[model samples]
Target: MRSPTPPDEPRFVLAARHMVETGQWLLPHRGSELYAEKPPTFMWIQAGTYKLLGSWNLSFLLPSLLAALLTLWLTWDMARRLWNPRVARYAVLALFVTLQFGLMAKRAQIDMVLVGMTTLALWGLVRHLLLGPSWGALALAAFAAGVGTVTKGVGFLPLLMLVPWVIWRWRHPQAAGPGRSWKWWLLLPAFLAGTAVWLAPLGIALLQNPDPALQSYAKELLFKQTGTRYANAWHHHQPFWYYLQVMFTLWVPGSLLFPWLVPAWWRRCRRADPRYLLLLGWALLVLVFFSASPGKREVYILPMLPALAVAAAPLLPGLLRRTGVRWVLMLYALLLSLATLVVGYGAVHGDGWAQRNAVKRAIDPWVLPQVGWWLIGFAVATLLVIAVLRLRRAGLAVVLTTVLLWCMYGLGAMPALDPYSSASRVMDQVRERIGPDAELGMVAWREQNLLQTWPQATDFGFKRPVAGQWEDAARWVAQAPERRWLFVLDKVMSPCADRSQVIDIGSANRNNWQLLPGTALQADCVARTHGVVDDADAALQDDGD
Candidate 1:
């Protein structure tokens, strides 16, 4: 419970919390606005988990953890069927040790669950299209694609497996497939059925309600979030080659072997190995699909990792025996160990690097030293493991080092960082300063502020313009000066806020938050809310009139 939800996790958690409290599972909300960025499938799972466990902190990340395990298991079984038991074991290990996969697994995000669904779909497709003409497997694959669609707009990515399957079949007429049959049409409906699990209910509610806000929400969710957002994203714009960079860095040790694996994959493909053809082909298509989009994030390409790992599994054993590959792996481990030790040592000694980062990440002074020691100790142990294993077992040492570092960061560092990152510390202080009986209102607030202090604080609105939110909040606080208080983000605080009357509650999430009382309001507060003309402009216009 010590670690708070990070970044987008709080947005999901707040929506799920609203679902549990209001019994509105069909629609999700973040603060006072409708959360239309993604579909409700992930939130539904999170809400269900909350109900089952009844502990928000423990249950929040459970779905992601379970989905990650499911993805690994499916990858293992698929590799075994296509290759051998040895390849299967290596496949799971490769995926589990990959940097991005493990990081996404521990967070309360939709990507991991989406990856699970997509992986299942791919496995089913491989089973039917490559191994058998089984109708059931085809239908299951279609259904999974549909479910994945509702989870995230790009969840249907696995269905792109058909492109490679078709090409492979064209090359060799004897390839396994569902064959010519009228039952092939059933695949479409099966996929629709999976989507209907969530969309059907949503369509029904939209038809029954006809409220304009609900109608607008449906339009935004179905069209804007999926189509417009993909075609012309308004944020996180990056160059087309961005995901290639992600592959080299975030893919880590697995990617470190790409230099050797690529040639081996080409030779297999040239020899017309259908397994490599389908797996590598699908992985490439996934990369191309996301790379075509202007807006990119590291997690957007995560679905490709499983297919890449499965294809590389057969080659990993032989590659690990190579001296050059072993050296590269060992060098990576050593560098990571040294980097952690340096950061830790600086933090413990109150060096400029540590102090600068503490301000940048909003880390508490005391917490930094404690976490620094943990990092230093972990680095020492990791260095010793590398030395003992030497080049002979560099692969094993890298895997062990990666796993141990994640564990240490999760157990040792996260708790210390949680209070500030999650806004728990800020909310706790607000409660303490205002006392239990005082009503609290929030202006220009984030999802974290409302989430950490739910049912007890009132927010103007999450997406409201700052000036409007300030006007509404100041009006609210003006009504009851003694018993009411306003929590404001420093960036949006009106110039009219009396500095002497506002209490700086310190910084969290890189933003300074302040607790403001009604006494802080100046006479000219109405004219000076952000993005509006100031008092001088208003007076000039009034005098001219």
Candidate 2:
């Protein structure tokens, strides 16, 4: 509903402050731009937050957090209107409590904004179409559509979801809508216009700062990153069953009933209510949209979370009726307690706490899972939430408030986690080993900006991180002890134990190590770089420079 509060810390904030301090455009970067890098909308939000808080990082996260809360608020209203009050309650809970959406909503990424904006538009559109396009409603709908489009490219797609209803509103406006004018004609055009308006600035900014890297980023985020190059290789490409798997992991507790509920939903919406079809179709269309795209990740399905959560409402009541609400509440309470234990243990028992090495890097979020603390916290929170629902007959508002509180808490904690477990930790230990003025060269792998830590390489500025030749990279590593210190991401740099006695630091993690998702594994690949070279002049990749 409103801009998020600005973060109090400034130096810790990344791109937006870079924009302010350097007055440089956001486009310039460390590697190939073929992926997608423009904070486009996110940067702007952060910029505003920076202005307000005089700090950048937390401020950057604020807008998305706010957007998520609003989305929860709207989801409750929409669920109540489209289906039942119970559905609204679950919808908000699902969006807020589910780890996946909760994590993303509080991050620096653009997807959270997209989710919130799109949900906002969907709410307004549904309200207008079903309740007769009231002018006041139309204005709200149009404004949200504009913000959504401005926030992300995917924002435009939701407008398509309105096509069926647009037809209903347009053709039979006099008989169909409350405003009852030809005004429905303006709705679709207004949506498109907003897309154009929002995108125009980003399009220009990118064009103005057209560097080679941006082209590479576009290729990746736009093309290569979408699909695996090896085609059938599961490493890069997933099975068609990917989304099915996503539901189990990302949806968490709700996934238990999700599959069975879908068919029931379809039957219920079969003229029993067309809106059920709308919600189902909304999720289905997003699946097809992503499936058809070259890029695929579990998080992509998040946009549909709100709708799916709301749809689960009918089943919750049944669960309450069949098992007794207390049982349902008890199970959640157990889950919360366990989660707290796991999180708490990780916080105290994990690797880097005593040294104040909480954040080894500026960007990594791999905090010890502090699983026990989370479990305990969840126990307390869940009990409170359950009490409100059971004792007070509390509206969905109670569920929503509980969820938003936790999501925001997790978001804030993530940055603290990143430093201890990522390259930042490794960098801190190894930077002291090499002599000053040593030509720091990368090894078989390079992370240009991925390893960007505070006191990192701003002096040299951003360099293209990927290596084109293994021999050259090895050479870079081998020439390293020539009085220069270096950081690389591969163990290949440490191949010869006898040739050079190198050490490992910061454990295993990757650039942006925290972003990599999976269970608490021992970490074979995401992070961990060796500190020495196999040959004094060996090369992992050769640039011939």
Candidate 3:
């Protein structure tokens, strides 16, 4: 079963829904002139899937799942090329159970696609380095980079791993193999050629149209989004240490083993183990690149996980044999069990703990009854850890423990959290309040749930006229003879208090919504203006006739 759609899923789904419904690839709610923030590759893929499946439910997730599988396969292949088959198998197991990978792989997002593409690129580069620089491998690597670039701007960032690899190659000329230096130079042209596959069509279409909206999209995609995110982030701003914190917590059991194994990996790198150097370079470059960005999200570091897994795979055998490592694994399992107990207690007993805990707050009261299942899962995982440790199957213990926990969370916790995480319930209420066909506009807030639930509904998107200046939806609403129905957040509804009859819809993301009539909204706007004018006569005079 699929888990509830997270906060960002609806946004991508909405965009894809628009493409399917209206045959428009751009973001419909972002105004007619505004293009989507990211390239249309993922959305287009989602649209195609939705079209084929005739169901929106699993359509978006299909791409994510494919990307995840590709990532796993590529990681395995890279590990195999770099080390032995045994190490490759261990690396795949380690990667499969990683918390970040498991969580992201299940989501309907582009992050996994980016991860998959970068992994492919890294694999291609490693192939060229280890098996001699074949033109085919160089082209594959460069093309992956270009395609990944179109997927997300940071796709090109993985190519930076080549710097360290090149440096190492120069230091030890004998390791350069039979490849000529000129073959390496072909990587640039191949990348540009691959990129042009998408860019060429888009550029021609823009030139043929030559509209402001298309131009705006081009500028934003090429410059504003990338430059602004790095220099001065508009959203999700965090300190450099943000990812460091994520490594410790969000990375989970794998992270517990990372610190123990990293020193050895680095020592191997110094000894010029080509595989170690490649994996190390891939992980460090990706991590440092994302960390340097002012805008940070835990998911941004996902591309590094495969590389880290490969780098750490070599030490798994020795580490598993150590008594101390087994003890540490046991301790980790105990902590997980303790957490499950505390959360289960909090779920059953009415306490302020639910309010204080982020995880608890996500679940609906109805789901509390099912909390026992989650606890059961944790207990089973803990017991399995002990059993596996006893059998000296340390790697299997890690995989089983992590997978069991995530499976339980997906089956029990996710469905329970659906009420808050999704807007389906709220949209039903909205439809009941306003007849299904009534035009709906949003003021001062945009909810992804709204778009996903009701794709056909008109979106005004904070288009309330401030002075006399009017935008698209505001201009249309103002001029229309028919009454308009709008959805406004509680915070923005204060101005319409007496003029409009506000019917409370549900809340999500800490914001409440109310359905309001258009006549009341107009009256409120006029009254507010009149009140402002009454306070200052000079201000009224300046408003002109």
Q: Residue-wise lDDT of candidate 1 within 1-545, one digit each (tens)? A: 45446567888888898898889888898877788888889989989988899988887888899999999999999999999999999999999889999999988889999999999999988898888877788899899999999999888888888888788778888755667788778779989998998899999998799899999999998998888878998777899999989999999989989889999999999998988988899988988888898888889999999999999999999999999999999999899899999999988887868779887867768887898998898899899999899999998998899888888878988777789889888888888888888888887676777787845488877766666667777778788878888888776667778888889976777778888887677535655545652222221110000
Top TM-score prediction, candidate number:
1
Steric overlap count per candidate: 0, 67, 0
lDDT of each: 0.84, 0.52, 0.70
Q: Which pairs clash inside model 3? A: none
Instruction: Give the poorly placed runs of model 1, Cα more than 4 Å off.
Output: 522-545
- Each model's RMSD to truth, in Å? 4.9, 9.3, 5.6
- Return the TM-score for each candidate structure: 0.95, 0.66, 0.88
**Across residues 1-545, which tens digit of lDDT does each residue of candidate 2 receive?**
11121121121234455555566544423322211433345665776787788854357668777878877888899888876776777667666666687767655566777788778777776777665455556656666666665565456556666655554446445554455468766776666666555355546756887776555655644343223321322233565667878888766656655555766786776653546655666677877766664445676677788877766665666654544443443465445554554555555465434223435333233434443345345556655665666533433433543464465366444444544433344555555454344444433333322334444442222223232222333343344334433344444433332223344444433332111001211122212333333342333222110
- Residue pairs in steric clash, candidate 1? none
Estimate candidate 1's RMSD in Å. Answer: 4.9
Which window of ten consecutive residues has the lowest lDDT sum in model 3? 536-545
- What local lDDT does model 3 show for residue 252? 72
- The deviation in Å at residue 528 for candidate 3 is 6.4
Provide the lowest-lDDT 10-residue window in model 2. 513-522
lDDT of 3 by residue, 180-281 (tens): 667777889989876775687788878798788678778877787667766787678799889989998878777888667878887898799877887788
Top of the candidates by lDDT? 1
Model 3 deviation from the true structure expressed as Cα RMSD, one decimal place? 5.6
